[model samples]
Target: MSEQSVRRPTQKSRLARYLIPIGSMAAALSLIAIIYLGYDLAKGRISPCEAVFQESSIGLKTKISFLKTEGELEIGREQLAELTERAQMTALNLKTCCTVLDAGRVDPEQFLQCKGSARSYEARLDDIAALVRTAVKEGMSTGSVATTAATAAPTPPAHVEEQIAQEVEAAKAVSRDFNKQVVQVRKEQALETLQATPPQNVTIGAQEREPNSDLLTTNGLSLDTWVTAAIGDGKDSDYFVFTTPKTYRDRIRVELQNRSTTLEPRLRLYDASKASLGDRYNTTTGADLSYDFVAAPDTTYIVRASNYYGESAGVYLLRVTPTKAYDAYEPNDDILTAKPIELGSDLAAGIMDGHDQDHYRVETGDAEAQLLVTLTNSSTSLRPQIRLFDASKASLGEQHNTTGGGDSSYLFKAAPNTAYYIQVRDYYGDAAGTYTLTVNEAQPGG
Candidate 1:
C-alpha cells in the first residue's frame, strides 16, 4: 500500500473516533433533557400557582404522616384518619387541577375552574396543617409516658386527655369553618358564571307579584316553575306560597339565583303554620342560595326571599322543584295521621329526612293473636326501628336493628278489635332512607 493511502486510512480512523464520542455525548444530553422535562412537567411547570399548592400539600402530608407515627400521642385515631383522608383528597384535587392546567389547551372556564380548585386546595391544606400542628403540639405536651427499669406504657392524665379532646374539637371547628369558606368561594364563582349565561331550556313561568312581602299576601307559585323577582330596597322581601302535590310526598328543592352583582340572596321556608322549616343564605356577595326539604303531601309551604344584608337590592330568580317522590303512605308522620296497614300486607315507605318518623295503625280481628311487625331497611345508612304504641298513644314495645340496613321484628299479642300504632324511624335519628314494613299474624303452634 502507498503511504498516501495509509495516511488517508489513519485520518479516517481519527474522524470516526471523534464522531463516536460526539454522538454518545449528544445522546446522553438528550436523555438528560428528557428526564428534566419529565420532572418539570410533573412539578407543574406550566402553572406556578399549582406548583406552590402541590408543594404545600406535600408538606401537609408529611406532617400528617409524622403525626400518624407517634403511637403514644393522645390524638384520637379517628381524627387523625380523617385528617389524613382530607389531606389525600386535597392532594388529589390539586393533582387534577395541575393536570388540567398543564394540558395547555384549557379554555377560559376550565382555567378558571382549575384556578378555583387550586385556591380551595390551598386553603384546605392550610387548615389541615393547622390541625396537624395542634395535634403534634398537644401530643408533645401530654404524651409523656411513665417509664421504670422495666418498660411500661402509661395512660395520659385524665385532665390532659380532656384538654386534648377540647383542643381537637376546636381545631376541627376551625377546619370546618375553612371548608365552608372554600365552598362559598366556589359557589360565588359558579353563580357569577351562571348569571353571565343562564342555563338553557329553563322555562320562566311567572313574575313576582307585588304586595307579597308577608305570607298572607304571598304570590302563588306552581311546582317546578321559575319565578323572576327583585328586591326593591333593603327591607323588601318576596313571599311565594306553593302547596305540595296531594298525590304523593316529595323532596322539594328551592334555588335562588342572584342576577345582580350587588345582591346577596337569602331564602327561607315556612310551613302552613308560618313555622320556619329552614333557611339558607349567601354569605359571599353575589352568591346564590339553595335548600332542600321533604315536603309532606297536600301541605302548603311558603318561601321568602330577601337580601342577605337587608341592604343590597337587586333582581333575582327563584325556582322550586320537586326532586323526589315518596311512597303513598306519606303525611303519616304522627299518631294523628298514622296510615292503616292490614294483616299480611307489606307497605314501602321512606324516612325522607333525619327528623322524619312514619306511623302505621294495625287492627286485629275478634281473636287474640300473636302479631309480628317486620321492618326491613332498604338503604345502607338506615338502621330501622319499630315502636309499638296503644290506641291511647301509650308505648308498648320497640324493636330496632343493631346493624345498618338490617331487618327488625317485634312480636306481641294483640287483643281482638284492639288498635296498635307502629312508629318507624332510624335508630339513630341521623339517617334517612326507605324501608319495607310488614304486618302478619303468626301461625298457631308452629
Candidate 2:
C-alpha cells in the first residue's frame, strides 16, 4: 500500500492535470464569444486592407495564368472574365490582415512568422499586394484571411461582349481594314471649306492694268467704225477712246457675251501732235481686260478689239471711257408754251413717271444735249435715278431725278430733231419728282 501509494499522481504534466480541463471548458465559451464578438466588431466585415491583399494574391495568380497560356489565340473574353473574378476573390482575403490586428484578435508579433507566406505573387512590385502578403505572413491565420477574401471577392464584372463588340465596330468604321480613311475625308472637307468660305472680298483698291504689247500700230485716233462686221476682229490699224489718268487708278473690266469666249484688243494713245503717246494694249482672256498709263490732258486713247485668241466667238461689248468723268447736268426742256404732249406715251425725251425710267435722244456728236430737271430739296436718302439712251445706250443724262423743279425742262441739243423714247424710272428716293417734265428742243450753239 505504501508503495502503491501514489505513485500517486506522478505529477502529471501541466495540461494533463489542471490546465487542460480548464482550457477545454474555456474554449467552448470562447468560441461562442468569438463568434458573437466578431459579429459585433467594428471591423468584422472588411478591413480595406483586405482589398489590397486580395488584389495582390489574385494579381500574382492572374499574371502566372497569363504566362501559362502565352502564345495562344486571343483569350476568349469568357475565360478572361473567369480569371478576373478569381483575382477579385483573392483580393478580398487581404482585407482581414490589418483589421484582425486592429481588433486585437491577431497579435502582430505572432503573425510575423507567416508574413512571407501571405504575400501575393504579383509580377509588379507595387506595395499593395506586397503589404498584404507581409501582413498575412506575419503569422496572420489562413482562416482569418481566407474568410475575408471570399466575402470581398468582387462580383464577376458584367459580361459586356455585345457592348464591347459595338464599341470596336464603331472605332473601326472610320478605318476599315488597314487604311486611314479620315485622311481623305479630312482633306476633302478642308478643300470644300477653302472654296466655299468666301474670298477676301477686296473692294478693288488699286485697279489692274496691262501696259505693253506689240500688236496695234495705230495711235488710237478713231475707231474703224465698220458696218462690215458688227461682231468680228477689229481693224488692225484702228484705235479706241478709253484712257487712264494715272497708272495707279486704271482698270478695264471686260465680259464676253459668254464666259466661253476670248478676245485680243489694242489701245493706243496720241497727243495733239498726232504722235503716239507710247502706251498700248494687247491681250486675250475670257474676263475683264485693262490698260494702264499716266494720262496727259490732250491725249486720246483707244480700244481696238477682235475675237482673237484661243476661245469661241460670241457677241462681246467693248467699252471705251476716261477714268475721270465730267460733271453731270440736270434734265431740262420747256414744253410749256407748246403742244398737247401725251403723258404715259413714249416721248421724244422726258421722264416716264410710271415705270420710274428716263428717256434720252442724242444727236450724232452733241454731248451737251441734256434734260434739265429741277427737284425739291429733301432728304438725300434714296437718290434713285433713271436715264435713257440710244440703241447704243449712251447716257443722255438722268431723265428723272427727285432734285429738279416742277417746271423742269428736258432739252437735248445732242439730237436736235430725232424721235427718242424716254422711260422714267427709279422712284424710291427720299425726294419726289414734284414737277412734271416739259419737252423742248435745246437751243443749239454750233
Candidate 3:
C-alpha cells in the first residue's frame, strides 16, 4: 500500500468515529424528551378525574337534602321507595367516581382520603334509605285500618324533621370537604386542574304523573284511598275526582298533607255540573289543607290542588272519605239564634268553614256568682279566640287570643239576671277544628 491509500483509510476511520458518537448523543436527547412528554400526559389525566369527582360530590349533596326533606314530611311508602332508588343510583355513581379518582394517583394519601370520604357519603345515604323504610313500616303497622283515614300516616314530630336535616347537613359537609381536597391535590399536580367546571342546578327527577307534564284526572284516581304525588315546577297542579255513589248520605271529606317548607297548598272543590262548591282551603308553611262538605249523591266532584305561591314544588299525600253530616245549625253563626247553654254546662262545637264563628247565650240567674268561661281545642291544632258581647252585640271586653295546646279562659264577675253572648272564632281566620265550651261558676275564692 502507498502513502495516499493509508491517509484515505485514516480519514474515513476518524469521520466514522465522530458520526457514531454524535448519533448516539442525538438518540439519548430524543429519549429524554419523549419521557418528559409522556410524564406530562400522565399528569393531564387528573383533569377529567377532578371533573368527575366534583360532579359526583354535588350530586350526592342534592340527594342527601332530598332524603332529609322526604323523611321530614313523612312521605308515603311509594315516594320513599322512589327516593331510595335515587340514593342507590347516586351511591353507585359515587363508587365509579372513587375508582376514577384513585386511578389518577395524584397523591396516594389524598386519593385514599377521597375514596374513604366517598364511601362514607354512600354509607350515610344508605342509612337514610333504611330509616325511610323503617318509618314506612312503622306507619303501616300503626295506621288506622278504617277507610276513613284511608291508611294515611300521621305527621312526624318537628324534632324528627330537625334530626334528619342535621344528618344531611353533616353528610353534605363531608362530601364538600372531600371535593375540596381533591381539587387541592389536583392543583399540586397541575395548577390548571384547579379550574373546576361550573356546577349545574340540581332538581328532582319528574315522576310518571308529574303535575306539569300530565294532568291528574278522575280517570287515574279514585276515592277512599291515599294517593301520593309531587307538585313539580312551573304552574303545576293536581286534580282528583270523587264520585258519591248515591248510597253516600253524608259529606265527603278530602285531605291534602305535605311537609314542604316551601310550598303553601291550596285546594278547591267542584261539582259534576262544573259548579264551584265554594269550598276552598289554603294553608301556610308546614300546614295541611283539608275540605269537608256534604257532596250530593250520584254527583261527580272535582278536587284541584296547587301551590298558593305558584313557584314552589314538593310531594303531597291526599285522601278522600265520607264524613258524617255536620250538625251545626245554619243561621246561628251570629248571636241571633245563639245556642243557649245553662250555667255550669259544657257544649261541643266546631268551626267547619274558614270564615265561620259560633255563638252562645248565657244568663246569670239572680245570683252574683263567679263566672268562669273556658274554651278548649278538642285534640286539634286550631288556634282559637273568644269574645264577650252584650245582648246588643256590643263588645264587653278585649278579645281572648291565647293559643297552643292550652285552653282559652275568661274569668269575671257575673251580674244577676243579665244575659251575655260568647263568640268563638278562629284566630288568624286560618284554623278550623272542633272545640269544647264550658261555663262554670267557680266558688268565691274556695
Candidate 4:
C-alpha cells in the first residue's frame, strides 16, 4: 500500500501526543504557582500590618498552650481554672482583633483599641504568672493551698484627651506648696459654691451648710451635740472631727442613725494622720449603730458617714459624746500587757471597744493538776471565745461555745509552775460588752 493509504498515524493522534504533554506541564506549573502563594502567606511575606496580625494570632495560640501547661503545675485548682479561662478568652480576643485588621486598612482609633486590649491581656498574663509563683511559694511553706493571693502590679495609664480650650487664669492667692491649709480653703470655696446653688430637688440644712467631704476639714463635733446632714450622689461623704483627750474625753461614744428608709448608713473612724482606726460599722437601712473606742492622748479623730450604696441619697443623724461606759484597761490587749491573775481570783472586765481582745496571765502551782477557767459575757448577743497559751505564747487549748451560751469555760493542765496566758476575743469582731472571768485550781480527772 502507499504511505497515505497505509494509515500513518492520524492528525488527531499526532496532535494528542504533543498536546497531552504540554497540558500536563501547564497544570504542573499552575500547581507550583498556587503552592508559592501559600508559601508566601505562611512565611508572612505580606504587608507590615498583615504580618503583625499573623504574628499576634500565632503568639496568642502559643500563650494559650503555655498557660495550659503552667496551670497543670499550679497547686490551686481554682487558680488553674482561672488561668485556663483567661487564656481561652485571650485567644478569642485575638481573633476579634484579626477580624478587625482583615476588614481593610486599620483605622487609627480601631488600632488603638486593639492595642489597648492586647496590653490588657498581657497585663493579666503577667498577673497570673505572679499569682502562680506566689501560690507555689505559699504551698511549700504552709503545706496547703493559699487562700489569698497578692494583688497585681499597676498598669500603665491610658492616654487622656487633651483640652482644647484656652487655659484659665492662674491662682493668685494660693502658695505654690499647696499645703493642707490651702487645700482646706479651696474645699471651703467649693462647698460655698455648691451650697449657694444646690442640686435640683436637693436641700442643704442651715446647720449643715459647710461640706466636710474630706478627712482634714471635717465638721467639728462637740460632745453631746447632734447634727444632721444629707448625703448626695456619687461618693458624697460627710466627715466630722472631734477631740478626745486622754484625761477628759478618753472614752467617747459615736452614734449614727439613718433617717431615710431607703438608705443604708455606714461609719468609719480615722485618726489624726487619716489612718483607719477600727472596723467599719454598718447597719440595715434606718437602723442605728453605736461605737465606743478609747482614744489616744490629745488625739484628733474623724467620723465618716456615708450611704453604703453608692447611688443612694439620704439623710443621717450623727452624735459624738462622752459616756460613762467602762474602758478596757489600757495596755492590756496583748501578751506584753497581760493582767496578772492569782489562783482563785475573780476578775470583771469589759471588751468595751470594738475589735478589743483582753489578755490575762495566770500562775499555776506545781502541785495543782489542772486549772479551771470560766467566762460569762454580760450581753447575750456577744459571743466571746477564750484561747489559752503557754508562757511562750504557743496556744495550748481553746474553748469557743455558741450553742450553750455566750460564755466559755476550759479546764487544762499546764507545765509545772507554768505561767499561762489567756485571751478573750469576740467571735465576729464586732461585739462590745462586759464579761466576768474566774480561775481556780482542780484535781486531775475531777
Kindly give the number of clashing pairs for every candidate. Answer: 0, 55, 0, 0
Report model 4's TM-score to 2 decimal places.
0.39
Candidates ranked, most accurate by lDDT first: 1, 3, 4, 2
- Which candidate comes out best when scored by lDDT? 1
User: Candidate 4: where is the Cα deviation over 4 Å?
Assistant: 1-216, 219-239, 243-252, 255-300, 304-319, 327-331, 366-368, 415-417, 428-433
Query: 139-213 in candidate 2: lDDT tens per residue?
Result: 234345655767642221123323333432432331221122223333544576567654221111112112212
Model 1 regions more than 4 Å off:
1-205, 211-223, 232-236, 241-250, 258-263, 270-277, 283-288, 295-302, 309-314, 321-324, 363-369, 390-394, 401-406, 415-419, 427-431, 441-446
Order the candidate numbers by TM-score, best to worst: 1, 4, 3, 2
Q: What is the TM-score of each candidate against the true structure?
A: 0.44, 0.19, 0.33, 0.39
lDDT (C-alpha, whole model) for all candidates? 0.74, 0.37, 0.65, 0.63
Clashing pairs in 3: none
* lDDT of candidate 3 over 348-398, digit per residue (tens): 777765566778889998778788888878846567788888767888774
Best by TM-score: 1
Q: Give the TM-score of candidate 2.
A: 0.19
